[model samples]
Target: MAKQLLAVAEQKARQMGLACDIAIVDAGANLVAFHRMDHARIAGIEIAKGKAWTSVAMQMPTANLAQSALPGGPTYGINTTNQGRLTVLGGGIPLVRDGMIVGGIGVSGGTSAQDIEVATAAVQAFAAAHTHHSTGASRTIR
Candidate 1:
């Protein structure tokens, strides 16, 4: 499943002509698969992984991290105290199956919205493929 997701992410990045750093992490926040496009910012590699790690670790999207850590929120200083390992920006999403989180995906090197768009497309592609295979339904990817 992780491999399939990574393939979809890579294909989407190529299709969008966006150089990106994509990271997939298992439910335990461990790295599963990663691809860093040529010319992507070298510094974004670990940031991307940390975003994915936070998603898998918290079983929620990374965007929520920012909101949850607002000035008076319970998670204030989380991103700061974590030493650059946490980001409140978009690009990380949890992979869910049967109501259980299986892994997560994080994309970097683009705008926050662009990163989310690419990651969302990859997730949608994976879900569509999985649904077809599980239900014996056929569809063309063209």
Candidate 2:
């Protein structure tokens, strides 16, 4: 899964001409794999890990937390409670299998949209691999 995720993300980032820092985390938010593309922003290293961790911890796409993490929002100070590991960014996605989160993927060093797209590639691949529906539909995918 890590190899496939890295290959897919690397290809996507290359096609888009953007360097990336990609990280994968297990269900417990433990780092499983990581890769930093040439010229990727140094800051992206930690951000990528945090994104994956945040996704697994929250069990949702990091983008979905953006609004809630804003000032005055219900989860406004949520970031402060995670020991500074929470990242409500656009590139983090939880990888679900059989209705449970199996892991997470995170991407950085690109625009928010690009980061999401890269992470989505990994999510899509994981979904396709675990497809259960006979009609080629994934039970845990969107």
Candidate 3:
């Protein structure tokens, strides 16, 4: 599943003409798989991984954290609490299967919106695959 998710994300990045880094983390926020596209920024590797970790740790889309991470927001200094591992970027998304957050996916090396777009594609692929194989539980990506 990790490899499949990476493939789907890379395909989307190719379609968008982006060179990016993608990372996946398990429910415990541990690295599952990662890919760095040709010409992708070196820094994006860590950022991608961080995004995935942040999503799983927070159990929410990283984009949503951006708001609360702002000055004077509820989580204004949340980023500073995790050894600076948390990022309020838009590319991270939680992968929920059977109503449980099973993992997370993250993309970097493009604009926030573009990263989000690519990650979303991966999530959609995951959902489709789940739907094709099983029929009972709900799946969500956010």
Candidate 4:
């Protein structure tokens, strides 16, 4: 599953002409697999991992936290609680199957939108691999 996720993200990154860092984490938020495309930003290595970790830890897409993490929002400063490892960015997505979170995927080294697109493709691939339904049709995916 991790390998498939990495392959899907890598393909998306290549399609967008981006060199990206991709990370996959299991349900426990442990790193399962990772890939750094040639010339990917050095800073993206940890950021990608952090994004995956944050998605699993928080049980939601990291993009959902962006606005709430802002000052005066419900989750303001929440990013500071996880030893500064939490990232309220758009690149992380939770992998869900049968209404349960199975893992997470994170991408970096592109614009937030591009990163989100790549991660989303990976999640869609995971969904397709596990079910017969159309990809990205899962309610747990957001």
- The TM-score leader among the candidates is 3
| Best by the lDDT measure | 3
The better candidate by lDDT, 3 or 4, is: 3
lDDT of each: 0.79, 0.89, 0.92, 0.91
**Candidate 2 local lDDT, 1-142, one digit each (tens):** 7877988988899999999999999999999999999999999999999899999999999998888889998889888877878898889999998899989999997877899999998889887777744356555323
Query: What C-alpha root-mean-square deviation, in Å, does candidate 1 show against the real structure?
Result: 3.4
lDDT of 3 by residue, 1-142 (tens): 8998999999999999999999999999999999999999999999999999999999999999989999999999999988999989899999988889999998998999999999999999888878766864544323
Q: Considering only N, C-alpha and C atoms within 3 Å, which residue pairs clash in candidate 4?
A: none
**lDDT pick, better of 2 and 3:** 3
Global local distance difference test of model 2: 0.89
Candidate 3: the clashing residue pairs are: none
Flag regions of model 3 displaced more than 4 Å.
136-142
**TM-scores for every predicted model:** 0.83, 0.90, 0.93, 0.91
List of clashing residue pairs for candidate 1: none
Backbone clashes counted, model 4: 0
Instruction: Put the candidates in TM-score order, highest first.
Output: 3, 4, 2, 1
Q: How good is model 4 by TM-score?
A: 0.91
Worst 10 residues of 1 by lDDT: 133-142
Q: Worst lDDT window (10 residues) for model 2?
A: 133-142
lDDT tens digits, residues 33-132, model 4?
9999999999999999999999999999999998899999999999889689999988999999899998998899898899999999999888787775
